[model samples]
Target: MAKISTTLLAATALIALAGCAKKRPAVLPPAPAEQATEVAPSGSAGDVDPNGGPGSDADFRRSVQSNTVNFGVDVYDIDSTARAILDSQVEWLARYPQVRITVEGHCDERGTREYNLALGDRRANAAKNYLVARGVAASRISTISYGKERPLALGSDEEAYAQNRRAVTVIIGR
Candidate 1:
């Protein structure tokens, strides 16, 4: 018992001496916050956000009223439902001037390639024009026709066709 007590006293004295030694400043000061260092809407993975919006592609879609509007087969006209969606989009745009978008016109797999491309162009333009008319800056919006190349749903049935015939509003930048 006496040996154990002596050993413990030495260990405690050594620990005390070790604690008295000075330590170098191991931590650096935090980097200064800079707005310029913030992520831009270059479509990089980091820029997109949900709260301030104009975020990443998915977050931007969720931030907006509607990211897609469907159309009837072979039609480029904007229906009432389509109009409402565009209206919501316009409202969202008004709130976020930094945001820019690309309207992608897609078609079902039923039409000829050339025909589908034409239809997609018309559809994309229709949505773009609607936004322009509703106070969205024309310069902030661009249109592209994917035609039947990119299908949201893959099948020969009407359900898949309907799902494929849509104009997708993509967030291009902030």
Candidate 2:
């Protein structure tokens, strides 16, 4: 009877241990290779270099008032401020017709990954459409949505969220 009780207690302990096993967090799939491109280093919007070489990333960043445009929470609409920034980008693109650019859409860490990805796509297309309408050739532009994966700022606060929710125009090639 003593041996049987010990075996039962051991079995119960094993069951409890099994129930307490840790679970691995869900992993997201990798982004596509074809969609990847080298992004130019970020800098201040006012750091314009009038004598920067033509068709260069520095030229693009300098000639344009800003390479990024921020959006409101859960909103992808282009506001007046975003329009002004895109206008600068359009003007720069006109100066270098051979250049190709990618507009990367990003989001803050608020919603599900799927929801953020869709929203990011819309934000990117909105910027691309605006640029195309303003005379930047459609063929010269491409867009990718990084969703909430690539954030400009990391925090749960409003300030960080504001910075994270943006579309960045990257000069891919000339």
Candidate 3:
């Protein structure tokens, strides 16, 4: 009985090995599903404008034109500068009442993070305040302070730092 059992076990092992050894057919998987496009060739990420094309609100590129204000002495301020930008931003926004924008306030890395954050906040607030004054609905604009976390010019030089410290206006959801 023991010899018969041993022989059966050996046969079973051999059968399992044979089954595993058979070569399965190599299959070329089907190509991934392609996205449809408008105006361009099919299967492309083409120009299906989010705002339905030019002269639309979503299609408008929010401009961040810069202006410098003298705050007396060499100790100039960016808060007022931001306010000017926001004033213009509001005017443009009024034309497209449905548009939303975020005011990103940044500063040079000369100061501590906490101080910079506060300063950046003030800067954005200044802009927000100006926008409010200029007849822009407060809800249409949002503010954020980068606080030197993201430097426009990555260098220790004053020139670079000056450029780094700025308020940028960005367009939000359509």
Candidate 4:
């Protein structure tokens, strides 16, 4: 009789615990629409592609000096070096008015996930704001933060950390 009672109690506890488990939702939100417009072939005579064709990612990279800007440790301020790089980006963006870009912020793998994410966001915004201030349209840019989840350099040394702490501008559409 005691064995039967103990078995019954164990089964009841197991069922109760199973009932507490939560089910994840199946539906997901739709992706946002692309912000850039297609470039017309005869839009402007001066808008000729430097490489081969306008509105291509390769053209944008080829036109700009650099697509990335590095930040100091735990800092999001745009220094003179970063400013120069973004200025070049702004000039390239001016030539390709229909182009759209995404600025991705990243950080070294030292801080907590939450902290790094926040820092990364600030870094991305800093770069975006600089571009907008220098005549790039605000609507043509979007920002995302990867924090320390995506590292340019995998090593744990200071050099690797410096490389990892950066914001990269990616040509998304045109």
Best candidate per lDDT, number?
2
Instruction: List the candidate 2 regions with Cα displacement exceeding 4 Å.
Output: 1-52
lDDT of each: 0.79, 0.83, 0.58, 0.83
Model 2 over residues 24-126: C-alpha lDDT tens digits? Answer: 5356444433444433344633332323555666687777889999999999999999999999999888877767888989999999888999999999999
lDDT of 4 by residue, 1-174 (tens): 999999999999999989888565333222222344344466665444424476556776777888889999999999999999999889888877877888989999999887998999999999999999988999999998888888889999999999999999977665
User: Which residue pairs in model 1 clash with each other?
Assistant: 48-55, 48-56, 49-55
TM-score: model 4 vs. ground truth = 0.72
What is the per-residue lDDT of model 1 for residues 43-134, given as tens digits with 9 covering 90 to 100?
Answer: 65445463444454556566667889999977888999999888888877776676678898999999777788889999999999999988
Model 4 misses residue 139 by how many Å?
0.4
Which ranges of candidate 4 are over 4 A from the true structure? Answer: 1-52
lDDT-based ranking: 2, 4, 1, 3
- How far residue 29's Cα lies from its native spot in candidate 3, in Å, is 39
Off by over 4 Å in 3: 1-84
Hey, what RMSD does candidate 1 come out at? 20.3
lDDT of 3 at 129: 69
Worst 10 residues of 2 by lDDT: 44-53
* Candidate 4 residue 80 C-alpha distance from true site, Å: 0.4
lDDT of 4: 0.83
